[model samples]
Target chain A: MSETTIGGIAGRMPKFIRRADPAVVTAFACIVLLLFLGSLYSRSFLSPEYLLQQLKVASFLGVIATGMMLVILLGQIDLSVPWSVAVGAMMAAAAAAYGPVGAALAIPFGICCGIMIGIVNGIGVAYLRIPSMIVTLATNAVAQGLMVVYTGGFSPQDSATGAMRYLATGFAIPGVPNAVIIWAVIGAAMVFVLTRTGFGRSVYGIGNRERAAYLSGIDTRRVVMIAFAVSGGLSAFGGVLLAGYASKAAQSMGDAYLLPSIAAVVLGGTSILGGRGSYLGTVAGVILITLLQSILSVMQMPEAGRQIIYGVVIVAMLLLYGRAPASR
Target chain B: MKDWRYWLAEQRGTLLALAIFIVMFAIYTANHPAGFTANVVQTASNKGVLLAFVAMAQTLVVITAGIDLSVGMIFTLTNCLASWLVIGTGLETAFGVVAVLGTGLLCGAINGAIVIYGRLQPIVATIATGAVYFGIALLLRPFPGGSVNEDLADALTGRLFGVVPASLVALFAVVLIVWVPFSRSVLGRAAYAAGSSETAAYMSGVPIRRGKFAAYALAGLLAAIGGLFLTFFTYTGDAAYASGNAYTLFSIAAVVLGGVSLFGGKGSAIGAIFGALAFRTIGDLLFVFDFDPLWQPLFQGVILLIAVSLGAFALFRVRNRLEWFL
Candidate 1:
């Protein structure tokens, strides 16, 4: 190429980059790369059935990530996911043991437990002015302690109800998993809410600049509280599903989901700083993380290695996309 | 009158933290079957000092408006490294100590480089590096069997002059050597400036990048010191994941209790030290009170929430409402 042409292309590169959503692009690219790597590790990794199973697994993370994304988008966070999930699963399982009414109310009761936690989280952040990080973390400890006391510090005695098991492990249509279907319904609802509603606009506004949103009559506090509540409920729902899959609730069962949920949300290109992101990006992120996880496990990499990779991916992505303009 | 009031306001957080520690320690000693003796004090100091060091490490980063989730991992890594190196002859042990501490400095430097130069967020960057540090720790002590020099370990952890705890003395010396100089230094002031308002700091020509980098790097060094102490106390290294995570979380709690603001640019390491002591006392209180082990987490959480909520009372005076977001 001519010198002038090369210079022109270089000069235009920043502009073109600015127009593309880095989170969505990076997530999709990672997914493709992970898929290729997975196939290389095991031929069956490329099969439709294997991929579908991965999607089913991703669905749980997806459900939780959806909630996390809502909070992150509001420039706040919910660290209560671990215990919230535990509460949901434990409550659902415990309620399931009582008979027909208990079984029927299991899911709602589980979700209600989560919403309650979320509301408390919301009150702390919105009204008391406590940093969400501290409040949620404190609440998480409280939940853990409460659960331990409730269970007498042993494994919970209750097992998942038949319906709970069906929701988690059962197939709905010929080949599709029920978990995937649930995730899709949630995802679709979220996409619609984020794209078409005043609440969505309010969330984006509040995330971008809370004071500005409030000045513009957004009722920012209410939006934040509701966002947290939704996050809590969804996280608990994810926990309930996990309990269903595992057939019982165990102490510290929700402990594993906290970091991965944040990872998935950020991986999908949702800005950890909030105010800008799409659920589509989050979906891509969830799939990519799941695939990366599968590939790593297939290689017999240890848990420590998996955690390191997970952390690295998050840092790497932030480096790639989170940087502000150099000229500034 | 005005000057003294201003001074009081400036020192309020530290004073509050100190008051909390004093009250908690007093209650703890009063309830103890053994009462307040050197043996009891030594044991408590040994436990409290480890967290105090870690909290001090956390304090530096928090002052710059950043958090180091990796401090705990760095503590674990150094512990593991110390177990392997802090052994043999006097000169050899000395060199081993330097090596372990140096590794910690390097870990902190990496975090600083990524956050300051690479422009990544502190929370995410540290989380990633923390994982890497834990991974190395796991590799070093997969089965948790390694030893430190017995002479060095006992000397550090044991009582000094049969009265005061050696660990407390060591902790004070560290505060004198590391924190005092850093807090007075230009870079330290720069860190405060940056945390308070980075844009203003930048506009005023403060070396915000250097200040933040120093805070992060020093944080790693402090965490490493905690690790060395861990090795001394335990005489072995175990790559305990839960323990590491717990330390990270508790450090934040300690910082808050110490009067360090999460929003940054405030508070003293001394306060955080006392906060660490006070928090450790909460657990001891549970033990002495004969509470069920199961109630410990719940009580700790409740106490932390209450302690932190005390800091939030000032928000009620905020009139603009916009300041709430800040």
Candidate 2:
């Protein structure tokens, strides 16, 4: 409430605020550039309908990236995301295959599976002293293997329930997709949690230096576990939305979203090293990736070209701002 | 306290990997319908050596405390290139092999340049390059219908001396030619020093950059060898994205199982090769046991989880909370 409390480190605060500005700004600029590029290929690229379609797609990544941002905030990563997304969707759909009760709890059931995965990942990374990348990578494999066994090496037969469909595709505030609303709500919550909550500050602290945070009595492991859990939950939630949009869960549905989410996060100026990033930048990043993808597809780029461009974009953005301060 | 104790401690990981491989092979052979036959062993070795090479590549990068997510992509790319180039008469096939390996070297050098000079994180940098390599692979083999020279493929994939699988022999030869010399070299020591503590290595004026660059480039070269072998086995090159991703993940798993610390500055390619063999045997065990083929993935996953969990036991010995970071 007091200006001194906030502005006491007046010199430091501006740099902190400004540090978040350029990445988001650059992302927005890229979005505009992409829009111009897209329109050159198609006249309707700038249409409200077309843009809304792109927004709906980006919401899926936005939701997933929200969780990614959290773990990344702690300077950790969740490589389990791809299969976690599939597990969430398939389990939710499988649950809905039961009766009314199952249908009603399908979404929650799916998210719970993701949370369980996160807890395991957190245990491995936070308690076991395993690196997060390896831990998450192993968990991803485990999740995939489990999913395969559950599906009998075949695609799941269940379809997304009506509620799932409505939540993902139906218009909530007329003309606005429900998925966009969902992403916005999730984004708002993410921003509030990051800027206004102690847990958020602790995440930044631990990412910056875990020992310092632990010594400060912040219960760093609990924070890390919670972050990974949230990431899992969010990824599964994204999968659920994806299943709804597609009307069913398919094997490996989450594979395509993994790199784009990471690219979006890093493009938004969040340090892959963790400890430094903002939610707004991630939002901008999600949109940028979505547009880039849409435009690439609209241009009828082959799979090879798409992959090349995608890689080039990520490396270029990373090279631009993601460099370490030359610790050597 | 004794010389033997020091040797034992130093070779602990490699020995463990060897133990694991022997045990798994025993189980596999015991359950196998044909028993412990040369054919089965040869088949297993052929399959295992592909992963062994990739694991060796991963070991090199990880030793420098970096990771090359692109290794699998390089493997795929080189496989595809070999499919196109490693064909025709003996002279042409030789040229193609050289070309495929060269492309792999170039790819690894690019990765090293970006990571070292560009000052980017190895993980993210490799992920980006991996995408590019896979794209190139896709472009080369849009369809899985390129040919490799049959003579070379047969000679490489088949048994030698009436019993020894050539693939396994090649793997052993590579260890002698590549890993042995590298391990004894100044650059390799620098890599270890860098991985253990980059700041300390830097302060000590270690050639961290060159060491790391060599590691990355060599990793690429090893993955390329794996690619060439893949072409030999499959007789074609298919840039299956899923397969590429799987190899990348499995190489990490193999590296860990080999007792190579993912944290870096520890372990050996010999351990990783044994780890790969053990991992491959885990899959084959299911076949021998007459389990449904679908159960293979689950079995592999569980084994990997258990193998990785073995490393966690060390954490319990940390007396000081601060030492957890170390």
lDDT, residue B113, candidate 1: 94
**In candidate 2, what are the lDDT values of residues A1-328, reduced to their tens digit?**
1232221333555755534456678888899999998888789999999999999999999999999999988988888899989999999999999999999999999999999999999998888878898889888988998999899988999999999999999997999999999999999999889878999889988888899899999999899999999999999999999999999999999999888888889899888888878888899999999998888888899999999999999898888878878864
Relative to the unseen true structure, what is the C-alpha lDDT of residue B260 in candidate 2, on a scale of 0 to 100?
90
For A154-244, candidate 1 gives per-residue lDDT tens digits of: 9899998888999999987879999999999999999888877999888888888888998998888898999999999999999899999
Q: Where is model 2 more than 4 Å wrong at Cα?
A: A1-20
Error of 2 at B143 (Å): 1.6
RMSD of each: 4.1, 2.1
* lDDT (tens digit, per residue) of candidate 1 on B224-270: 99999999999999999878988988898999999998989999999
Q: What is residue A139's positional error in candidate 1, in angstroms? A: 0.8
Interface RMSD of each: 1.9, 1.1
Please name the candidate that would achieve the greatest lDDT relative to the true structure: 2
**Which residue pairs collide in model 1, if any?**
none
Candidate 1 - CAPRI tier? medium
